[model samples]
Target: MKVGFIQFSPILGKPTQTLERLEYLIDKGKHSDILVLPELCNSGYAFNSRQQALNSSESVADSKFIRFLHEKSNKYNLYIVSGFCEKSDKDLYNSSFLVGPNEYIEVYRKSHLFLNEKDFFSPGNTDYSVYDIGICKIGMLICFDWVFPEAWRILALKGADIICHPSNIVLPDLCQKTIPGHSICNRMFIVTANRIGTEDNLTFTGSSIICDPRGNILTQASDDQEEVMISDIDLNLARDKSITSRNHIFLDRRPDKYLDIAKAIEESV
Candidate 1:
């Protein structure tokens, strides 16, 4: 499977401009099986209050933009994973949709909402969900959720080979040092697509990246540039890696010791 990560600066408060950028990339990278975009790529992370997000939010059912995204997936014969401000049942959500060629396959809402995000968006309730795409079990999660080991563990235990993360992470130190180690720790492919440019005084230095199960950085987008990072992944390779590896970091966990630690915490709390 060939995955393409679209890293770009989102125009503040303009979904039309963002859609246009996405369309251009889809046309350019016609060979990609899956095109991944950043978290809140549509809304530009402009959250003044809950009322502001609510005002800017769009309905998934009635949104012509979302319908156009679905159309683009079918037209290009690619799986489209894009982020948007979703307004469902009077609650606002920072959400990403995994859109197949035919329909929306699954939706992963941002679980660990960032600073000022908790004020505007509701945190996602589910752990992690996996979808079967071709020969691989693909899992999707959002930005801050990647910091939690439990999220990836759930996906890995459920038999996910690839974990796609749609994020807005800036800072070279965090991306270069911290995030890559996640792939190594979990023993799963990590495909992270992040945003770029200044939105509401926050400047995003895009470093969208894809890492193999061995924590090798396959490809990464340069900071402060609009670019797409593509990498070819063989599904069989992941299975081979999982089965052939004898010294996995996750497999050597002392669960019995951890359980006692958890029990001690519960008693203390």
Candidate 2:
């Protein structure tokens, strides 16, 4: 099936303008099976103050914007994933959602909150989620979650053929060094959508990309530019590749030595 990734332009705290552009993308993506977007793509990252960030937050349960996402997903007969700030009575979470044609399927609150995000956002209590989308079983992580292998490893071990990561990695060399290694080691297709343009002093370079299970860059965007990439990936092939000699490195693990690692770290904390 074909998947699309949108490296959208930063709107600088304007969800209305961002939604306008996103509507355009949804209209244009009628032919794709799934459409993905970058982290904080709906409302630009506003970290100047806690009150400002809190004011920008929206509830996933009652958001009209989320309703529109469901509409678009059903209209196009596609699966949708995007990153935004989620507000609940308890706390705010940097969250991502997966909406299928039928309903909103799953939501993942980011576990690794970035520097200032820790000040305003609560870390996710649950682990990553895996879902069956058409013929593919997919997993999700948002932004900084990719820096930790445990996030992807958990999904990979859970039988995900593809891992979708919505991010805003601005550093060129850091993204260059990290992305390929993660794709190669995980032996699963990595679909990443990053953002572009200047928001609050941070300049995002939207090198959004997709990698095959073997770590080959199938499609990549130019630095600091807005673009959409669509590519056909056979989920069956990735599943088969995971067990092949070329991708066997992912399974050659020492799980016995790493029992309860996530819980152990939580206990120590």
Candidate 3:
């Protein structure tokens, strides 16, 4: 499968201009079966206030951005996993969803909030979701969740072959370096789509990456470029969890000894 990421700076509060630019870029870029766009690519990240964040969010039920994605997916005959600032009822979530031809829309909200995001968005109440797109099982996780190994493992356990990460990252080189470890540990392909450029005082780090199940960096983007990075993937590699003759990443897990991981902070204390 041809999988990749679009790395670009999304102009905050200006969905029309941003989407237009994105459309143009995608039209000019190389073709791929699966494409991952940056976090909050439609509404943009780095909100100034809760009200602004709310105003910027689009309803999952009726959103122009979602329609745009579907149109593009159908137009290109591709699967798009994109980050969206979602308005569900009265709450706002840092969320991303998968859209494509002949597939029902599946949304995954960001379970972990970073820094000031807690002030503007609610912690996602949904469980991790992996969508089956006929060719492979795809998982979605937003920006901050990359730091949580458990999140990656959950998707791995659920039989996901690829984890598409939509991020507006600020931390330099941390997630990129750490993700290879995650790929090796989980034996899953990972596509990290990160945005470049600064929003207010925060300057995003845009080294978007794609890695194989064995932690091989297939393709990588620059730290400050608006580029599309693509790589050809053998989907079968991710389906196997065996490390050697006697070892397996999943079958050898000692879940019984890790019970304290699920306990609340106070209970653990």
Candidate 4:
């Protein structure tokens, strides 16, 4: 399958300009099976206040950006995973959703919010979800969720061949370096779509990457450029978790000894 990411800077509060920029990039890129986009591409990040974020966001069903994406999905006849600022009822969320040909599939709200994001959006309550789209099984996770190994492991256990990470990262090189470790452990392909440019006091680190199951960097973008990073990955590489024929990534597990891990989290929360 063709796996890739689109890296670009989103203009804060200018959804029209940002959407147009994204559309231009998509049109110019090579055809791919699935593509991932940066976090909050529509509404942008680093809001001055919660009210400003809400003003920039709208209900998913009513969002023009989403409508435009729906149109583009059919135009390109490919799957798209993108980050969006979502407004639901009176609460707001930093969320990501999947768009298939002529339809909107599912949404994953950002479970772990970064600095300043906690002041604006509600914590995500959704569980880890994986979708089988015939070609391959795919999963979604937002920016800060990259820090949690358990989250990535859960998706791998759920049979996700590829994990789409939509991020607007600020801390330089931390996630870019750590993701390959996650891919090696889980035996799954990972596409990390990160944005560039500064919003207010924060400067986003680009370096969007695609890593194979063997911990090889298939393709990587520059830390501060607009680029389309793509790689042709074999789905069978992710499905096979065998390390040395005798040892398996999943079969070698010692879950019995890890019960304390769950207990530790319960005590802290």
Query: Tens digit of lDDT per residue, candidate 1, span 1-269?
Result: 78888888766567788778778876776678887888887777867777767766787777766787788788888887777788899788888878877775687888888787888888886558888877577888887887777788778777788887888875444754666777776677878888888767677768888888777888988878988778998665455434345754546667777665446556877
State the lDDT of candidate 4 residue by residue for 145-254, as single tens digits.
Answer: 99999999999999999999999999999999999999999999999999999989999999999999999999999999999877999999999999996999899999
List the lowest-lDDT window of 10 residues for candidate 1. Answer: 236-245
Candidate with better TM-score, 1 vs 3? 3
Return the TM-score for candidate 4, rounded to 2 decimals. 0.97
User: Which candidate would rank higher by lDDT, 2 or 4?
Assistant: 4
lDDT of 3 by residue, 34-144 (tens): 999999988888888989998889998898988988888888888888999999988999999999975458898899999999998889998987888998999999888
Better of 1 and 3 by lDDT: 3
Residue 222's lDDT in candidate 4? 95
User: What are the per-residue Cα lDDT tens digits for candidate 2 across 58-91?
Assistant: 8887776678889999988888888877888968
Candidate 2: segments with Cα more than 4 A from true spot: 241-251, 259-269
TM-score of 1: 0.90
> In candidate 3, residue 116 scores what lDDT?
93
RMSD of 1: 2.5
- List TM-scores for all candidates, in order: 0.90, 0.91, 0.97, 0.97
User: Clashes in each model (backbone N, CA, C under 3 Å)?
Assistant: 0, 0, 0, 0
| Residue 221 local lDDT, model 4 | 97
Q: Against the true structure, candidate 1 has what lDDT?
A: 0.77
Model 3 weakest lDDT span, ten residues long: 21-30
